[model samples]
Target: MYDSGKIIAGLIVFVLLVTFPFISNMGKASAKPKPSIDTPVINEMAVKKCVEPKEFMRAEHMQLLNNWRDSVVRNGDRIYVNTAGQSYNMSLQNTCMNCHSNKKKFCDECHNYMAVNPYCWSCHIQPKEQPNEQPKENML
Candidate 1:
């Protein structure tokens, strides 16, 4: 109890130092990060769609791509039949990446938001630019 004043002052200083960042950011409006999905390839399409619906694609696109990889690479199956009874070619480069050509605009936007690094491009070859040529639908 001899140096109680000094001990209390030191404790108060430590608490403020620990909580400084939280207190400083309090009541400050944070900028909402708007992820850009609209690109030239996505625009100008008569029918803007994906293999799956927008909600499903947003949540499960990685899983669907993984399934496509397994089907094409492991099982030697080149065709992927979606839930809507539509068959699409199971090639990521030709089918998926063809439409989503701009990796920075489409893929990276969502990936960066969620902080996920999918190892898709590591193995799969990036699609070459086919400007002015709209990505053809997987019609069987």
Candidate 2:
């Protein structure tokens, strides 16, 4: 009990050091990370909609994609009928990646933010990047 005073001070210092980050960041305005979804392909689509609703797709896209993979690979079912009764080819490359061609912008955006390493790319080749085509001007 002779070193009780020193023990209490050391404990206080340890607690403050452990909670330093929380204390320092308290009440400070932090920038909200905005995941980019505005790719050229998506913007140019005639029907700006997915097989499912946007919120559903955002939250459960991995699960949906897994289901599609299993159906196509295991059951030989190549068609997906959404809740809206619309049928789509069960393909990650041709169907899902068709609209979301820019993996860096669309897929990577949320994945990187959430620190999720989806194994979809390990088996599937990423879609080729769409080249930016500039309009040609004719000289008289």
Superposed on all Cα atoms, model 1 deviates from the true structure by an RMSD in Å of 8.2
Instruction: Write the residue-wise lDDT of candidate 2 on 11-110 in tens digits.
Output: 9999999999999999998654465657676789888999999999978988999998899899999989999999999999988877777676677666
Candidate 1 stretches greater than 4 Å from native: 1-41, 127-140
Superposed Cα deviation of residue 60, candidate 2 (Å): 1.0
TM-score of 2: 0.71
What would the per-residue lDDT of candidate 1 be over residues 4-87, giving only the tens digit for each residue? Answer: 999999999999999999999999986544545476666767788888898998788888888887888899999878888998
Best by TM-score: 2
